[model samples]
Target chain A: MGIQNKYYGWRWGEEDPIFKNLGYIQNVLGYIDPADKSFTSNNFKELFYPGDFDLLQKSWKKYKKGTDHAFEMSYRFKHKDGSWRWIKESGLANVFNTSNNPIGGIGTIQEVTDKKKKYTQLKSILKNVSIIILRLRQDSNNQITVDHISKEALKYWNIPCETLLKDEGYLRNLAHKDDLVGIRSALSNSFAKMEFFECRWRVVSKEGNINWCQGVGTPLKDKDGTCFLDIVITDITKEKLYTEQLKVSEEKYHSLFQHSPQPSWVYDLETLAFLNVNSAAISKYGYSKDEFMGMTLADIRPECELENLEIQVQKTRENYLNFFDGYFKHINKQGEILTVHLYSSPITYNGQKCRQIIAIDISEKMKYLKFIENQNKSLKRIGWMQSHELRAPLVRLMGLINLLTDQDSIGKEERHYINTEIINSANEMDIMTKNIAQIINDAQLKEKMNDVQIIAG
Target chain B: MTYRLLQVDDDPVILFLHNKLFSKYTNSKIEQFKNGRLALDYILIDNGPDISYLLLLDINMPVMNGWEFMDEICNHGLENSTSVIILTSSADCTDLDKSKSFANIVHFIQKPLTKEKIEKLPLLMEYLALQD
Candidate 1:
């Protein structure tokens, strides 16, 4: 075993009695040589040992001359139990005397097994915490750095934590190009105000896919007012897309409502007033928006038609039917009576009874019916003339020709002349009948032609 | 003795042809009235021969048409006892339908009276005889 001597408050010879009383030191197997008076009794034996004696001597000689030379060494020592025990030996060299420069040193040796065990336990705890804790640091130049990050962060980024921490530009490069400027500005503003900021932006992951991230950041400012941002990011792409889709759907419904060609209206069932009316309904009914809003079905229809309209409303309320069509007299803004064909259906508006109606005018159809009646009257007159007056004259002409041809018992020359006269009169009667027939035919043809034109028109 | 037959029509040619044809064909005196009003007056006043005389009626005549004259005679109940036939060149269904409304309308014949159609006139005589 090695021993170290340390000097205390007394001179070296004055401590000789104390050293002599220590039998463990006097019975030592090793002795010091006087030729090298620089050597100490404790260090001499350690230096003469075979393994590290030269190194120890060289170190002692090199440091012995310093005004303050205190040294400590730990090594294995042989114990009485025939086993090696770890020990620490410490000594302070005496450098108080100027003339008698070489004195003894005093030291103590102790075992440290319990302290080593505690230190190992503390080191294990530190390693565990290092794997879970994350710390970020930034310089005064706004260069961000990550000190310690959990392994989970490395897996999530699909890159080594060291790579990400070493280069601040690597994290900036992940930000979407379009959002980089705004994100940087927001971060700067947040730090300047020493406030928290939250924003959503696109980022490129290590896998090269664009991801939407909602980042909430707080400024960590130092006493000098310099700040760094610590941000937490969460994925919110699906929710953002759903919100955009909802907006598009609302716009589509609005377009359909505004631009549909059919005249459509929603009416309040209780008040019988129009709740909503499209442009087509306004133009068709010749009513302003205010006028239509104030009027009810009974006000628009004739008094006699109100009962039928009420029945339709009752049926709609009962849910007996969804659609119906009927004819009603409509008065325009000018008070002109119009025959209108109406189609109505039940609908719900804001959880209230409502109906939609479409109307068409049919006044021209009634006019055509009256015109047809007149045409029938004229045709009857023509038929009466053909059957009665024209037949009478033709009947007489046929009788006359029959009589003239039936004549007998007359002189040949006189018969010839009379027969010639009779034949001439008969031919003239035939020509007259033919002209009358032609006139009737022409009148009938004209009537038919007029009828065709009316139908085509 | 010949029975006098009065023919009324607005057309002059139709009137002349009627006078000549009836005079040569039948042993009856035929008189021509150009308008329905004149014919109605003559038939009302004359009532000639005390043997019913046939009144050939033309529907489209000036002053008084056939329908008006017939209506007048009917209102007076004169058409019920007189022998009358509606002679016209119209083949309209409306005129035919109107003929049914008048009891005095004995027969309806078309215009341009041919010999074959005239030969069938004995059917009118047969109807008159049946009435007698």
Candidate 2:
């Protein structure tokens, strides 16, 4: 046995003091005796786990071929406590007969059950996480390479993990042209400061699809003194799209509000303070935007309408979600009373409950209505005068002429009286007609003046 | 019983025409006044329980118009004995409508007291028959 052991170059015997003292080596030392052809003795079959039998058989077949090389394999082994453990076995077949047939083999076994379990857990974590994790290493020569990449990187970027590890430029080249300088600067800064690194950039995948990505990394150092960066890249395409669309919509509405022809304003509901006023409001109210900002809704109301304004404000506060429309009297900077038609609606403005109001100046329209009313009154008076005052003399004239023509039994004196009466009635009708015509002419001139005023206005 | 015909107007020509028209239509003597006030005063002083009056009243007159005269007549309890026929040159529908509100106003005639219009007054025809 000693000569066979010496031939295998394993001089340590079962009772050797040095080997016995090395309890760690003693527990992992395993042997295969060529003399025991099937090698089933010494509890070999009992300690070998059934699941790893094929691995053991394959290793033994190489040894039986008389190949003089060291081989290593990982398999499950039964411990003394009846628990299965992952074991890494490394062995060399050195003992051979004169005929060159191997007689025995020696190997060392290492218990790696904890390391295997941790590796499986890490792999499972990497597989379940949606974000791509990349481990980048920088050597002493300042060369950087992708040391490890998660399975998600392969799925996300549509690039093979081996390809990324082999060609370090593959991932870097995927960065958008516009963001290349930013990526370089951020990386250099992180490396120089040994600080947390963060960058937002776009990446074009192998499928030619663009993706918005955010990369966050922590600079670290491995046991070997090599610098490393563990980075997590998250897909932010949806969020970026949402923010961009929101920006565009806000700009659109802002322009609409600013350029509207009617006077419009936004006021806080709780404070009744002006939050925003449009250009039209600025010009129409004769108040600058800064001045309006410092004033409340009551500032534009006449003294008599203040109480009504208070009541309306209270009602609006209670029904903040409702739309309101009304005609109100307002006073401007010039102290001219104006009739304004107001349209208001509730909205969330600058994160506050507020109402936006549009005011249409209708003072001129009211004036026009009043003018129409006065004209109608004048027309009615003229109708009464035409029916009664003007017709009275004309009827008298007709009657006198009838008397002259139809009455034949009258005397000369009566005929002379009737002739003078006819002339008097005719002269009366002529003056009255002239008076009515003058009155009508004055009314027409007034109407024409009003029409010109309206057109000019 | 006595029956009298009265003509009231602010216009002298209208009063003259009334006299001529009534003279041609009936033999009953007709009295004329320049305005409702004169005619109302005449009625106040001369009207008797046994006397009946038919007034030809003009609406647009100075001092106590036809409407005021009718109101005074009503206030004096003379509406039953005094019948009024509105005589004016007014073609106003509102005046016709206003005449309906006075119970004593029996006829609305647009004027110069034409023969046909006078002939159309049933109250005048009845008064003339009463005179006979």
The candidate maximizing DockQ is 2
RMSD of each: 21.4, 10.2
Residue range B1-132, candidate 2, lDDT tens digits: 898888888887776666676666677666888777898899999998899899888888887888888888888888888988898899899889999998878888888777787677777877766654
All candidates: DockQ? 0.11, 0.50
The TM-score obtained for chain B by all candidates, in the order given, is 0.80, 0.89
**Pairs clashing within candidate 2:** none
Fnat by candidate, in order: 0.23, 0.74
Q: Could you give candidate 2's per-residue lDDT for residues A365-391 as a string of tens digits?
A: 887787777778777877887898788
Location of the lowest summed lDDT over 10 successive residues in candidate 2 chain B: B16-25
Candidate 2 residue runs with Cα over 4 Å from true position: A1-162, A170-174, A194-198, A205-207, A216-234, A298-305, A331-337, A409-457, B1-132
Deviation (Å) of B97 in candidate 2: 9.0
Best by lDDT: 2
Off by over 4 Å in 1: A1-263, A346-353, A368-457, B1-132
Alpha carbon lDDT at A290, candidate 1: 90
